[model samples]
Target: MKNTSSDIEEYLVNVPEERKEAFKKLIETISENLPSGFEQGKSSGMIAWQVPLETYPDGYHCTPGSPLPFLNLASQKNFIALYHMGIYADPELLDWFVSEFPKHSSRKLDMGKSCIRFKKVDDIPYELIGELVQKVSPQQWISLYEKLYKK
Candidate 1:
């Protein structure tokens, strides 16, 4: 269920009213913790936090036109998805999240390499997510992204 809306407000309008607050909270957590240079708006049909094209003109390796994504949040039919690039770029961060999240959250950790699925708001480990979001600065992410592409 990919919503084609490019505006964050338009995208949120597609989100069910009941889940809107949760989505906003997720946005807040990411915004509060994200590094100083990342921009927040819409990208990839969702609310994306990223290093703007002006900041890193090289963009994503997979999509040259798209900005280098740091985090993305979307409301789906059944759940909300938070895409955290930090964990994808750094294996140790993923390892720490997998081992530590469950200790603080009752919900089982549901995640892929970069996407963390939250079936309910409570399924989100907000504090841990914030910590993860803050682990890398925008400059750091560019370095990591560049390093990966070099290989």
Candidate 2:
């Protein structure tokens, strides 16, 4: 099923008010910084920013059934999550991020296959995150996916 911004907002019901505001602010910041042609939408119940299908006929691999760009943002009860499909498909990028922002042995990076989870706004290095986001152009991301997935 297609996800919508309202769905994402509804899922955030359990999030604390303060955290909700912080998450919203972060989302706003990301929205403002995204390159043109990237539209805001929702997928899998998470807020997403992506290039429209008209821009990339192949569609977003992260959400294979959907035709939107695949970048995702979502909130869980404990943390806010950001996902870039390239993280799982691009080892160099993942290695660079892990090395540059080394996590302590005691505290994991709280990452899934592609998602990065932050318990609080302060937990994230905003500048580094911004740099990472900027580095992945829509076309470049598609190329990376093709190189890695061969699809």
Task: Assess candidate 1 and give its lDDT.
Answer: 0.85
Cα deviation at 70, candidate 1, in Å, is 1.6
Candidate 2: which pairs clash?
Answer: none
Per-residue lDDT of model 1, residues 3-45, tens digit only:
7896988888888887888888888898998879999988778
**Candidate 2 Cα lDDT to native:** 0.69
Local distance difference test, each candidate: 0.85, 0.69
The C-alpha stretches of model 2 lying farther than 4 A from their native spots are 1-15, 61-65, 102-108
Candidate 2 similarity to native, TM-score: 0.77
lDDT, candidate 2, 12-103, per-residue tens? 56456767776776677777666666777776777888777777776756666565555787776678788877677788888877776654
Q: Per-residue error at 23 for model 2, in Å?
A: 0.7
* Model 1 alpha-carbon drift over 4 Å, by segment: none
